[model samples]
Target chain A: MLDAFLGWTGVVFVFIGVFFLFLGALGILRLPDLLNRLQAGTKSTTLGVVATSIGVGLIVRGWILFAAALAVFLLMTNPISSHAIARASYRAGVKLYPGTHPDKCEERKWKLPEDGEEK
Target chain B: MRNDTPILVKKITALSLITILMVGFFWAFTEMPKGSSVNVNNRVSRLYILKNVKAATKSLNSGNFFAKGMKPLRSDVPYSPITFGKSANLEDGAANVVTSIVVDYRGFDTLGEVTVLFLAATGVAMLFFGKRKKNIIKAQASLIMSVGTRIAYAVILLFGIYIFVHGHLTPGGGFPGGAVIASGVLGLFLGNDHYESNHLGLKLFESLSGMAFVIIGLTGLFSVNSFLANFLPTGVIGDLYSAGFIALIYIAIGMKVGAELSAVVDSMIVDTEEEWS
Candidate 1:
């Protein structure tokens, strides 16, 4: 009885993870501007993957440790990688969405070059 | 415009070429034995799979062919089941069949592959040999990016070492392990603008590891009468110390590949004066 309940729970988790992954993909496609897309893509996908791996681990009890390790690794790396990309693009003069206000990068003494100057 | 052959002539040539190719393909296909008619027991790969090469060869060449009703074949030999942790004293003791084949059965091919990679790295390095200027990155990496890279590099390095060390028992091996380490080096490059790998150290390490591979092969030749033979005792399958020289060869390959690839990345990322022209 316990095994069956756990199995069903795992299946539901898997479905939820897949749904989130689909939403992330949709956001990547539909979101305007690079920074917003990066935010949507990274956050949703990280959550999606962690959920999916946990679900898989619950289903295959023997591989729980490996799945957990993978999840931890992903969690540590994903945000840093996204940060790197965003910093690089900003330096290269990718324009912010005009609606964005209170530009914080300028406060950090980051000189924004003209669009083609960085190249 | 240049004058072209007539359309009819072109059509005739193309048709003839197609006909010739089709005929050749059909001829080869017909010559090959198809489906269940072919006996796979006759293939050398069957011996490798069954781990019965020595025994099968002996049974076939035992010199009792005329007296027997039928000739002894490789398929006639009985093979015991290979358990993950229990099987021992095997001809090749690696738990992973792919590892056994690549390192034991066909090690020379792997050597050739490593050599090819070495040559390619050498060519790339030579092209960018002179004093290198830092490649321009418009902005500095953020504090989080730099700090996170340092933490991640340690973990990545540990994982790479684990992969190569456990090559005989697991799915991963030297090439992948080395690539993983090189990627960590690449992350280092991204995180720090001034960070440079020790060039002399990398070159020395790569050369020494490559030499170690050759020396091991030579040891096999001297002691066992064949190149890259499994000269050391293969312990129990799935054990850390198992698979005889496979682990040693993998370590050598992993180190060599890691150093060579790191050097290649270094050369590619740093700009040379020639690029300015």
Candidate 2:
């Protein structure tokens, strides 16, 4: 019963993993802009990889489990690092979608208030 | 213009033809493995750690404290987890443990990653922070945005510090934490252009942290077997003092990354200034 349960859990994880991959692909295809696409790509892919790693851990069931867990941890970290890359890209003046609403960043200017006077 | 049009058209046609040919080749290679299953050797090697993992887990669960101590590091050499875990305990004095491993034990890789960050900061600085030859004046934002962002600044800053300090216990570490902290500064950059970072201090921090990284790597070569080896005592396992070399490496990486990212923000902000002369 326990063995069957483990096997079923493993199958479920694998299914989830495949589902995440499909979501990531769809996100990449459907997202409108570079930043939006990046958001979709990284989050979905990270979740997909983690799910896949967990599934592998269940299937292999040993030191390979530790390795799989490490892979999942790495997957989590990789996206944050990639997000930094994407943010850096945006700061470096990559354009947004033309029809998209004006960005908070593009319209905003920082200024100090002058002595309680309205300009 | 007329002559150039044909040349452009010819180039486009040739590029498309080559792309199609490449795609055809890829499709053909992908299908060749469809029906064929490569036989994999299922025989376990004597040294396969998978066999021992069960024993290790059992030892961990068993109440025999001394026997558990005798178990080898969970991860082997070339597999970084053990090295990171061992080193982090030794160097950082961090209690949660894993934070030290990622930051200190595999610090050289962390250094390379930091350099990538530095490069990114440089790129962002160049694009957004450079002195404007022409005055490109920006408009002020809505009160709601300005006020909301201001409130967010404090929250984000706190969150960044929380992430950095609690990195060992949780998923975040220096890289993520540093970026979070940088994001806080980015809030300031977006909200107010006049608030610029001190360039001199930023430069000093960037250079010093960068140098410290190199020095740390070199120290490993001189004191240990190879580069980035644990030159310090392993201490008692599972204690804060355990991973001697690892702790120091993590601290250095965290500080270096934090400072370097701040510098990146500084550079980007400074570049926004209009040329006075």
Candidate 3:
């Protein structure tokens, strides 16, 4: 009985994780900006992977420790990578939408260069 | 002007060529003997199968009567799986036949492969050497990245070590394990600019390991009367300490590859900086 319940729970988690992964892909394809797309891709996919791994661990024997390890690894790497991409894009002068209010990162205020002074 | 005719011709030619190659490969695959007859009724074991195979070869060779329409047979080198698969443990005290073959039977080939990697690394390092300024200040990674990278680096390094160490017993060997180790170094490079790796130490390790590999082979040649022979005592068939020379050679390869790859990455990173500067 306990095994069956655990299996069902694992199945549920796997389905939910797959759904989130689908949403992440959709967000990546549908989002307006690079940052928005990157955000969706990283956050949702990381969580989805963690959930799926944990679910697999529950369903399969001898994989629980590995699943936990992979989850920890994902947690360690994802945020940092996302931060890097965002920072790099910002430094490269990828503009955000003007409709968004109070752009704190726009404090630098990139001005149009004089015609001859372009690097 | 004449673009349409040429384009059409090129497409048709490419399509036909690809189709021909695919069909030829498919036909060859289909013509191959598909069944694993050995496992059908558990009748044929090691010695019997080998004997039968030999017999079959002899019979095929004996049939010299050629027909007018038949294609010429290219009977070349005979393959014997029983030699390695059955007597691997007996020969080298190694459980894995593939490992035995790589480390024992064809170690010279592996050495050549390592030398190729080393030469490639040297070429990359040379390309990056001329433009490098003494003690160039590198940009530091952000706080979040630094912390995360530190954690990831440790874990990856540990995993790489595990892979290299347990290579003899497991499916993974030195090449992949060393690549994993290099990835850890890459992580460190990403984490912080102040990641002070000892360039001297890396180079020294690479050179020393490569030298040790050759020296070990030479020593085997002198002592055991064969080049790259299994001279050391093989401890156990399946244990960690078993396959003495194979294990040592793999360790040496792992260190060399890891150091060389890390050096390559370092040089490449420097090369990129030169491009921007």
C-alpha lDDT score of every prediction, in listed order: 0.86, 0.61, 0.76
lDDT of 2 at B109: 71
- Tens digit per residue, CA lDDT, model 1, A1-119: 88888778878878888988998999999988899999989999998998898889888888889989999999999999998888778777798889887878777885744433442
Q: Give the per-residue Cα lDDT of candidate 3 at B238.
A: 72
Give lDDT tens digits, candidate 3, residues B120-164.
999998777754544444334568877887888889878887777
Ranked candidates, highest lDDT first: 1, 3, 2
After TM-score superposition, the amount by which residue B154's alpha carbon in candidate 2 deviates from its true location, in angstroms, is: 4.1
Predicted candidate 1 versus true structure: per-residue lDDT over B117-176, tens digit per residue: 999999999889887665565555667978999999999999999999999989989999
Error of 3 at B111 (Å): 1.4
> How does model 2 do on interface RMSD, in angstroms?
11.0
Q: Which DockQ value does candidate 1 get?
A: 0.29
Query: Which candidate's lDDT is highest?
Result: 1
TM-scores, each model vs. reference: 0.80, 0.42, 0.73
The local distance difference test score of model 2 is: 0.61
Instruction: Kindly list the per-residue Cα lDDT of model 2 for residues A1-119, writing each as its tens digit.
Output: 88678767877987898899899899999988888888778887787877777777776677456757566455645554555557556655687888878776667863433333344
- The candidates' DockQ values read 0.29, 0.05, 0.29
**lDDT preference between candidates 1 and 2, better one:** 1
| Per-residue C-alpha lDDT of model 3 across residues A1-119, encoded as one tens digit per residue | 99899988988888888988999999999988888899999999998998999899889858989998999889888888998988778666797756657766566675433333423
Residue-level lDDT tens digits of model 2 in B118-224: 78877866556445433233433334444545666676677676675555455676667767777777766665535556766766776776777677778878987
lDDT score of residue A68 within candidate 2: 73
Model 3 TM: 0.73
